[model samples]
Target chain A: MKKNYSNEDLHSEQGATISGQQQKAIVCNGLTKQFGSFRAVDNISFDVNEGEIFGFLGANGAGKTTAMRILCGLSYPTSGEATVAGFDVYKQQERIKKNIGYMSQKFSLYDNLTLLENIEFYGGVYGVSRSEIKIRSSDLISTLGLQKEAHKLVSELPLGWKQKLAFSVAIFHRPKIVFLDEPTGGVDPVTRRQFWDMIYEAAANGITVFVTTHYMDEAEYCNRISVMVDGRVEALDTPANLKKQYKTNSMNDVFYELARGAKRADN
Target chain B: MNSVEVINIVKTYGEVKAVKNVSFEVAKGELFGLIGPDGAGKTSLFRVLTTLLLADSGTATVEGFDVVKDYREIRNRVGYMPGRFSLYQDLTVEENLSFFATVFGTTIRENYDLIKDIYEQIAPFNSRRAGKLSGGMKQKLALCCALIHKPDVLFLDEPTTGVDVVSRREFWEMLNKLKKQGITIVVSTPYMDEASLCDRIALIQDGTVMSINSPDRIVKNFPKTLFAAKANNIYKLLQDLRRNSEMESCYAFGEYIHFTVKADDADIVRISQIAERENHDGLEVKQVIPGIEDCFIRLTLDSGQKIMDRKK
Candidate 1:
């Protein structure tokens, strides 16, 4: 069963609606994105709770990134409405940007800038105070074991270190929510585990996390995950529930089952 | 004759010890996995085995040839796909495959049967540049190139990573098929679930092996009466449960909280009433079987993280 929220709690957040508030961390209705004849993200709807670690999952081109772009205000929905963090994605994208931190799967840290400079530049772009950026940047740099590398160009750092530092910068703003599109793609398991720990720490401090990954095991990490196929959220709920519902021991099986089902339906 | 064998291999960079005294073996036609999280020396181990880097110490042999002394021969005979996408970006799909095959002194036509299934999927885009292919297609092309030489052993380092999920599944499916072809596959991944897909896995942490066994046996060996419980304000319930003296370790597992208690304690029945007292509605608690993640958690706790249960 999905977590049922009270109408009052749903509407408690500022400028939020009760119908969409129950699943308010993210609310998308009839969301669709099309590139000419191809529907990148088909019409879909789902609600993410106030502080849920919602997993936006799919195979490559399964519309996972496309859906994320729409929700993140990076790309517009073809014919639907989406409100991210209670701000309309289309009009209040700036507000949404301020309230959410994003780490693209290709979270490319500039090779030319030192760790500190990259952090400073991003912080400056976000209109953060110079003093605040410096303080948080150093603390984050140290936490990620990049103190020595802070003075070195990001290109000089290893891939593992680059990934960790990227994560620190993404959430440096302490946004209400953070979006990670395959943030741990090539990271080692230990580092990925550490990354998940950081995600948990952020969640504990009341930050919602939205992530997309191909690894089914990582699906087990999200509090709730939605599997997109052919542009619709075919399955949604906790990993356990979805696994049990599909009678599959793993999310991989669930994905195959739904994908096959979708194909059969299409034919 | 062992297909792959190593003794006390050590690799390091500067003051940091990337790999320390690591050794393992892979039998001919066997699918072996070097399972570890990032920084667990997986990449270093792969690099050493593939002969891309020399070990500071220790010795290794593949197909009866020494990894160091016969490094060039080994390079030509083994397939190596690094974690990151490494291919000629300017080359087209067909060109990339042909180039790799030619590099190994072979032709794609000679090994056409080997990569036919995979290549066919992207053949329509044979003229598409390697840089232009989708993540999944790029993965297929890379695999095709790696297999073009029909190597005796295959080394894939997080091959499915960065690809879409559907493609990831397809890739694993392809690997399974290759295993049937008598290819000795040595793959590494930080993903625990993928670890299970291998014939046998070595769970490495901090440059040490935690366990080496089949996935089923490993989960079966988990020694804990794991239970999943959750209620209204589930996170709060987890915190409250951890404070309880009966609980041993309480972790948030997806929608529910996975917990363990002292084995002898029959006070497990107290969860519902406690939830009621905490003003939690419909507290659902049930005993659950352990999975790979569960095994990992217990392993972490065993190594001394001190996970506690909720108190009354």
Candidate 2:
């Protein structure tokens, strides 16, 4: 099982004090994915420590979604190697699928389905026990404040509430690592703050989180983040160090500094 | 003349109340903003204000014309670009601008000077299909189409939501230029930091006004002393600080925790000591300016609506 970690811890030691620790949950080496003439994910290499909320950031076409898709075994990598949960992504895709949960950028719950039904469908498809799903669904709905809305259809709920509910369902199965693509894109600040709290709780409970977001502010929430630009990992570090290196006050500026040219260069 | 006003306006999509009893006024030539995340009723508010959709109840007047009764007149006087790129994707840049201008019973060449700054950048790509252009170009073209009519008021809903930083900055610059030309503008955005650019904003959430004031005044209203403290392990530091009895509330703020101390609780000495005891490395502390994010965090905590007991 992975242990949860905040961004500060991974940043403290800085500069590779501990490399190849046995506890590292994810390792990527020369990972590359290509689509004919276009390279979606170029030669990128990084490791996600056990239970760390790793943030993947870039412009709209920076290949962030592609990298995560490859990690989750949803797509094939063109070259290089990645070991998720210590299993080779290419050779053990089925094993990776079994152990990981994925929530897409458009992870809209079945709108017409009741909250409980949505949870049951995801759990049932994942093969979680009926008893476990029942117990877990109740705990999740309560924590996310969906008690009154549990019986309501997802389409009827407000977008913020739906966002929280979707996230809750994403992690309900206790997957070793959960990959989220822009989970907080269009949510209110209050709901965003609450969503981060849920993420903290998940990390505390020993679940590794890999998330992608364009909202630079949300980048502050990750334990460690990597800037993917034009199919390459441009910068990967704790938020503080990245800000220092980029000489910027906010992640918005840092992202611009990293992505400004690489983005244009790619196109 | 007042730019726009809504009186007890109500909008509903069947049983759901997207915009509920909303009312606000935008003075002439002012940059008023409707700030909220998705489904905070931002787009719906804009649709009603721009006269795209009629309010179910109450009244709205844009440039002194009713949105329902005087919609054709109101439509002739307002420039609007929806949240999505609603321009004709099949048309070229020039064609789209000309089409919009023709729809308003005008011509782009007649108002080319007004959109000269934005239209010039994409004029070289005037023949490019709207869909073939890059995100930034698409935004510029959209602005051009909206400006072709040279309407007295402008309504932009989440124009920067999906664009890159460079493009977003460019779009804001265009808005500033348009504002200077005395075109009253009401824009909506989910990003709080952009609130500072507005003359006044209604910080909304869940379809209710949280606060309405300039960004500077809003930040000035944030109560309590804030500090940015960081160590080697920031995650554990937050968990550790949140548990410490001395601090009132501590949450992650960018590179450090934007924490507020309990009144008369303890000084900075005690705060650093707690951090040090936890072996938080390189712990640096500073007095920093409160930003929109800080104000937002304070609003939730100071509202006295505690969801759960503070972990302290």
lDDT of 1 by residue, A1-267 (tens): 112323422333444443345647788888889989988778899887777888887655577767887777778778988888888878867667776788864755788998898899887776666777877887777666556667998876756667767877887766667899778765654345556657766787778899887667677778888887777788898887988998977777887777644431110
lDDT of 2 at B85: 87
On DockQ, the candidate that comes out on top is: 2
DockQ of each: 0.25, 0.32
Q: Clashes in model 2: which pairs?
A: A7-A223, A8-B234, B232-B281
Each prediction's RMSD to truth: 6.5, 5.5
Global lDDT of model 2: 0.79
In the range B1-312, model 1's lDDT, one tens digit per residue, is 678898888877887788778777888888888776666788888888899889999999888888889998898789999988898998998889888988899999998888888999889889988898777778888899889999999999878655554566678899988999999999887666677788877777666667778778888988877788877666568667867776777776655778877654434466455445656676888878787767866776676544441100
Give candidate 2's error at residue B102 in angstroms: 1.5
